[model samples]
Structure formats: structure tokens, C-alpha cells
Target: VCPEDSNDSSRFMDLWYTFVDPYATEVDEMGTDEANKSVGVLRIKDGRKIIDAYEWKHDNDVHLLAQNDELIIYELHVGDFHEKFKDLTTKIEHFKSLGINASNINSYFFF
Candidate 1:
């Protein structure tokens, strides 16, 4: 269920993948004494339910970046670079040839 946050319009308002129940199919509106506003569970393009409520833990002992200056990050929009995700996978070799060790995709590509 999307607990609306107190933020301006520029900020993200809708909850993408917050609390999720694998057995449940819809969210119940508990505070709807005047109007009816209930919605079904959110799913991905492949029709699988989304569950991102798990807390992520990172280990710093691995030393992902020994030196910040040594990092070569390449940012790109998947839709703009290629229309399909399978097509983008074919460009991995191309990015490696350009010395791009890390890649970042904008969140807008998912929504």
C-alpha cells in the first residue's frame, strides 16, 4: 500500500514497491467512509507481482572501489540507447571496450 508522503509535486508520490503480500491480491482502503478507492496489486510487464520491501545490506569489506578516481562509470537511458532490453545486452562488449567498469541507468526507465 502506498502511504502518501509529505513532499512537493517534483518528488515521487506513488509507491512503486513498498509493502507486499504474496497471498494478497489487492490493497484494502481502511479509511474510506465516504468514497471507494481500492486498487489491485502492482505487477511487472511479465505479469509477476513486485516485492521490494526486503532490506538490503551491503558489505564494505569487499572493497568495491579501492580508489574513487579509478572508477569509470557510464550512464545511459536504456530506451534511448535501444528499444529493447535484449538488444542492450548485445552492447555489453562495446561498453567494456570503452573502459566502462560501472554503468548506471536512470530510475525513469523502470517506471
Candidate 2:
């Protein structure tokens, strides 16, 4: 079940206690009352719930390098590409021949 469907507070609290509470050292020390304020809670009818709470620290500010017009988008299925082209370089060459300046090929799951 997805976390977005939960609407019950108690079920959300239970989920927070079970999944997030175990790993949350900061929240544990703060006690349940105070912890409830800081952490988001959700409840579901089908016995599914989620606690959307975490400390996400970013080392640096995010910078978007690619602009809208500058981006060259290529959408293709990995399985289809693999079945069609046996070699990686050959596929890139084919894209190059078709006037594609830069080919962004996904190396299966890696790239």
C-alpha cells in the first residue's frame, strides 16, 4: 500500500512507532508528545500507515545545469534497444548519423 492514502491519525502513530521510531534516536529522546509535533503521521484503512519524518541534510545548494532549450531528450526502452543493437558504439554512431549531437545512452541500469 502507498503512504498517500492513509487518513487516520492513530494508524499513522502506530506506523511511526513501528517503522520510524526504532531507527529515530532524536525522536525517541524527545518523548511521544513532542515527537508527534516534529514528525508527520498518516493512517490507512487497510492496516497500512507511514511516518513521513526525517532529517535530510544537503552538503551544498542544488544547481540545475541544463536549461530547457539546451537539453536533448532521448526516450527509449532498454529492452528494445538491446534487442535492436548488439554493440553500444554502433548505436551511438547511428544516433550521430541521424544528426543527434550528443547521445545519452543508458547502459542498462548503470548509466
List clash counts for every candidate, in order: 0, 2
lDDT of 2 at 11: 48
Candidate 1 per-residue C-alpha lDDT over 4-61 given as tens digits, one digit per residue, 9 for 90 to 100? 6744545544534334455655576653543434434654656876765866587554
Best by lDDT: 1
Model 1: residue 49 alpha-carbon error in angstroms: 7.9
The TM-score measured for candidate 1 stands at 0.40
Candidate 2's C-alpha runs over 4 A off are 1-12, 15-66, 82-88, 101-111
Top TM-score hit: 1
TM-score for all predictions? 0.40, 0.29
Which stretch of 10 consecutive residues in model 1 shows the poorest summed lDDT? 31-40
Q: Please state the error at residue 79 of candidate 2 in Å.
A: 2.4
